[model samples]
Target chain A: MENKENILEVRNLSINFKTYAGTVQAIRDISFDLKKGETLAIVGESGSGKSVTTRSIMGLNATNADVVDGSIEFDGQDILQLDEKELSKLRGSKIAEIFQDPMTSLDPTMKIGRQVAEPLMIHQGLSKEKAMAKALEMLKLVGITNAEERINDYPYQFSGGMRQRIVIAIALVNYPEILIADEPTTALDVTIQAKILELMKELQTKINTSIIFITHDLGVVAGMADRVAVMYAGKIVEYGTVDEIFYNPKHPYTWGLLGSMPTLDTNEDVLPSIPGTPPDLLDPPAGDAFAARNKYALKIDTIEQPPFFKVSDTHYAATWLLDDRAPKVTPPADIVKRQEHFNKTKQG
Target chain B: MLDKDAPKILEVKNLKQYFNVGRKDEVRAVDDITFNVHEGETFGLVGESGSGKTTTGRAISHLYEPTGGEIIFEGKDVSKLKTKKDEKEFRSDIQTIFQDPYASLNPRMKVKDIIAEGIDINNLAKDKADRDAQVEELLETVGLNKEHANRYPHEFSGGQRQRIGIARALAVKPKFIIADEPISALDVSIQAQVVNLLKDLQKKRKLTYLFIAHDLSMVKYISDRIGVMHYGRMLEIADADELYAHPLHDYTRSLLSAVPVPDPEFERQREIVDYDASVESDGKQRKLVEIAPNHYVRAADDEIQMYKDRLNS
Candidate 1:
């Protein structure tokens, strides 16, 4: 794992969207790296800029989106500085994105087989016969049964899960180095979602493609991620390995998120939901974006943003609670008990 | 605990909802299924997409008339209601909260008017001023203030809009509410808020609920009893805890195993049960067999014995 090469490096990335109202600071200064064959999950609620940060890697941000600062280095080249022509050359061949809704992401008029083949033809410049054969092969790879017959069918012909499989087949047809799945399974059911996540992980072993799985579901994150980036109001509030973030979280936002989710073992009537809404990105927050909702926020948190305090070699949390001068604070009892339960089970 | 002797508020006996019936391309959206929601208890119907949980909810709410079987509401067979007034009375007794908050409410109407629509239709309030007051009270009851009455649905956030949906549902003072994936469209933080709100309202009003959702954990938290559905058929039904602890049917087991737990270590070590109903059922006609007190599973005679043996084990 240590020897694996860094495929993508995002350093101090900030972005804004110019709307009629004003410029909305969508992605605050956030930094993270993706290893060659690892899955890095970005977890956050809606409008927390999790999607914006990941979409920036593929240069698929909205037309009004502005990259105000920092760089996204894919392989060795900085993607932000690249022109549309250069970005287009790298887009589907080197980096591909699978969006949430398969119905909307896929074309209604186009056949499923042809849609999957287009990327191969455009990226690798394969002939029609070659591309179609490869498209059928990719469809089979995604566990689409009767690929021979179903490949000719349109997107509407497939069910929700089957359509998502087609979308994945299209994204992975060219063997892209990085696969950006933005809530790919959110539209599917729990069983289908498990299958899709399993499929993605299985494909990673075969294709060795680095994945950026963006979703708000912590349960999904626990299952799929090698490393996790917990986003809050356009900024990464916590970043660590999956175990580190779940077992030894430092950020208040992460604690709230972990506590809010009702587990199978939950006996309580009401979950402790994170109070208040996320900060408005239109004006953006002055100090720490999460300070308003954070229960253990310090005075400095409301006035000045805290730096990323290193917890270990792989873990970092952007909160004043991690500061040496700040008073000691602990996560909720349920979270601590869950960690303990896991630890005990691991030991036994 | 739910009252073991409590009367069933709503009883669905072998309910079937089929689309394009008597045609070559007939689709059985909901197959023969039976369940009962006791008075003052929440009945959670859970399944994957295309499993017809929503269809069942709609059928029970009379949004879509069932193709077969009887929906008996409080000792009366509702599908057999002859007069329009009888049907209207039945409707006012049972209301529904849709999945998508954004699409459920009218964009052109003000929040007050939307909430008052139910009141005006049922003539629940005497005058316009009384209706407005009732609307405001409903809004405040759902955590929104009276000031939010005049604003349009577009002016509110997703969570606020969902609250308005709840308020609208409550406006009719219905005895039962079918919340079909009500919190699924909301964000994680707001989901809890909505679920808690629903729970509080249920306790306060002693309202019976048919809570339908795909999210197993949330359903478990809110429901006293749960029924697992697959491909428009009931797989298992039991106390939420019992169902979670000892899932009887293969489909139920698979559904439970598929739900991702938040513990990284547990999730990594977890075993996912993959059950394809078509393959497992072996094309046998299923019958609901009660293996334990108030616990039911759909299985053939041989499978029923197997389940009973497994329960003892």
Candidate 2:
């Protein structure tokens, strides 16, 4: 896995939004890299800066957003320094994004065929006939049945699941090098979500596109991501391979997130939920932002921000509990069970 | 946990809710669905979008007039309540917590006024001072502070707004509450907070609930009895554990199989069982039949024997 080239590298990216109340520091010093043909999932709750970080990759941040410091390097070029004209050229042909709601993502007035073909025509300078042919093939590739007949229909004619398929088709039509899907299946039903996830996996193998999948669902992340970055309070608190993040998480916030969800076999009477809400971004915390809700918080956690401590070659977490002087604390019961299972698998 | 001998709190028999009746564009949002909620138990109704779970909840709350069938509450038929006093009594006994907190709550109203709407309408409090006291108490009951009552709904977060919604529902001191996708709009971490709060409140108030949601795992955790609905029809109903362990209907099996487990190993091997609705359109009349002691599935006579055999094997 380490031999694969890094297609995208983000280093110490910080973003702040100018609002009427005050400047909201949304993304704080987050860094990670996407390996070629690998999927890196950004998992976080609302306002955790997962979406903002991915949006920065596409240069899609809002007008009021200020990129304070850092660099987004795509193929050795800093994307943050690119002009709008250059960014637009790089958007569809090089990097494309799929938003959460398919209902509002596609243009309501446009036909499905034109919407999917327009990108190809604009990016590749293909003729109308050539682009339409390519769009029909892309539609079929996304598992849209009867693509020839359905391409002429409007957005409303398709179902929620079908509209998402079209959205994926539009994103993959140009064979972009990097695909950023932000909560792609969050708006669909579980059954439909299953189909979409399968479609995404299939498409990734065929196109060999590096993906940046951002979602709040741990279940989806487990299935889709090769590496997982757990974000909290506008910061990447922990990051590692998918197995390390799920089986042997180091951060307390990651433990809370993993334990809060009830699996199919969970028989616990009460969920181990995080006690309080996230801190106010307007008045950002001076120390570790998660210290207020973390049950095993050391005194230093509330006074000073902890640096990232390496657990393995690929796993690292920012928590005072990882410090040598801090006392050891047991994670929740469910996470302990998971660790046991992980160890058993590794041994046998 | 559910007691076997518990009395029925709400019973629906062949309840139907249809839109555009006798027209070309007619749609059956909820067909002839029959189920009974046991006293002091949470009954979870789950399905995908457009499955009519929300419609069933709205019908039980009297938000929509049923096109056909009966809804008997506490041995009294809900349709028979004609007088204003009777309707008022019925309304106070049953309350609802809507899915979207941002839309469900009034943005202009203060938290106190929103929570005290039921108390004021029912004349539960004596005066302004008493009303204020009751509002503050309700706030505390839902884990909010007295100072929060003076703020508007926009000032609160999604989870806090949901708590306010629950507080408003409990303000009426209702016997049964219908929560329609209450946690769907909330974030993942906040969802657990709201679910635990709901469970705690149920224990404290001895409340019965009709919990409706699409997330099957959470539904199984919070509900004692579970019902599966699809395309405006009730496909299966059983104990939460039994339903997850051994789903009798094909649609139920497909729905269960689609739920993603958190374990990566399990997710990697998970296979989604696709349900074919054409099997039901074979011109065979079907009804809910008891396959096990208390488990029920909507199937024809020929399919029952097959389900029974599958259960034994």
Candidate 3:
């Protein structure tokens, strides 16, 4: 089921931030691929370097950030090698990003229409009137009503959900090949979140743009992503189709994450929370970063980092338990029951 | 003495909190909402932004005087507490933990002083040494070290600052607490830790909590009963399991359906239920009607029967 045509191929990408305390190894040798028109979700806890990896793709990392090694190949061309003039051309026109908070991202002084139209004017060299006409069309496409009149208003005048709609319109105004949405719906309510997700799914189908959706919410990932990459300590611990990652997960970290999340279907008390906090990235562990917190961790997990073991042609996981000589270990009982429930639901 | 059928610690009757009242465009933040929270139970109030969950919480805590209705706490009508002594007593028994830990805490104040503010105001402590000891114990109660009391709020992380916030709320030995979206600001991993901490604290102190949050799943995990609100109106109120398993109201069903499950297969196949209030209400006056043994739904007379039929179906 693998697609040959790749839009973004990240290989052994290592990133570090030069902090005053010390060098923080934010991302360590992470690699993944995004096929054309596929929605790939990067899911992890806050400090797991999900944002760092995605931002590096957009060349939006902090000034203290260093791309230690590796390459980011976008549509057969390495983006890291592109000059500033060339890179700016590709940024909004080819790879646009929508951040979590629209209030901070938008300029309070400017009107919503101009903010959306500015990208078109810069990238496409369209006249102000033409750009605004396209912006209004984009706003309507994102399900905003009274687009013609509302486009003249400032960001604060719109509601939280409407502001997000404006942000989405701005991002998709250029019809970028890739849309990097980092927790776009985290700030909105459930009803609004559902509407935004539906809008994004509809727009993706219409524009045929690959999306790198970054979120800590697995449920959001489940709804939106075709493929899932579970990151930990700046590495893709498990990469597979959404089904494989959710139902047939291999890594212990992935199991912990699934067990930790409370669902409407279950009445289990004490959501089996991962016992320990994420490892401090300033002094990253030598072995698996999740070793300390992982209950089913093997002795080898504490001694050496596990390589990505192939579970299938499309599934890969980094865990010592996947080794041939390692003892067979099943997932937590809750996860097992959840999968069984999923199977039943699927068949029913 | 607490009983299995204990009397309600809090009863909000026809509570109304309107912003910009008597104006051309008045906003009814909490429009005639009524509910009872029994002792030692977690009553979760959940809704989206602009839904008045926070306002309801603030009104119940006496942070904002209700424009209408009575908030009866421990047989005392707190909405009309006029005397300074009565207000002080109310403040001691009912405390709040604000959502944004960073903004709620005074950055310039030491942690000890922050936690001790309630104790000092209520005169719960005898002297400076007594206040220090009380602060230390409160700190330990919320899973923080006593040494943390000497530091400022800026020195702590978001989770730690929230723990300090919890300590501050608990310093007065309050019988009830209003935790307004407390864990929403923390990270996923830290969220669980704070939740676990809250649960443990609740069990230890036998405290009644009015937990306000938007995340339905987390609310279910933490709360025994939940009240669903939308646009300043209570839509439904029921046991968490019952509400999730058999949601009767269209708005309740839609809200439940909108919650993203972590399972990919379910999410892919799940259909979103849209409940339009204007269409459903049909310009009829709606009231909070009891449908089941303990379940309540906001519906018109005709819609109430429809909900009953839907529930039976």
Encode model 3's per-residue lDDT on A1-348: one tens digit a residue.
395588888989999899899999999999888998999999998788899998888887888998899999997788877777988898889999998998998999999999999999999999999999999999999988998888889999988888998899899999999999999999988988999999999999899999999999989999999999999888889999998889888999999888877787656556677776678889988788899999898888888999999999999999989999999987898888867876786799
TM-score, every prediction? 0.97, 0.99, 0.95
Model 1 per-residue lDDT tens digits across residues A47-96: 99988887789888889999999999987899999999999998888999
Question: Model 2 chain A — which ten-residue stretch has the worst lDDT?
Answer: A263-272
Best by DockQ: 2
Candidate 2, chain B, TM-score (2 decimals) = 0.99
Cα lDDT tens digits for candidate 2, B155-242: 9999999999999999989999999999999988899999999999998998899999999999999999999999899999999999
- Give the residue spans of candidate 2 off by over 4 A: none
How does the DockQ of candidate 2 come out? 0.84
Worst 10 residues of 3 chain A by lDDT: A264-273
DockQ of each: 0.80, 0.84, 0.70
Best by TM-score: 2
Clashing pairs in 1: none
Better of 2 and 3 by TM-score: 2
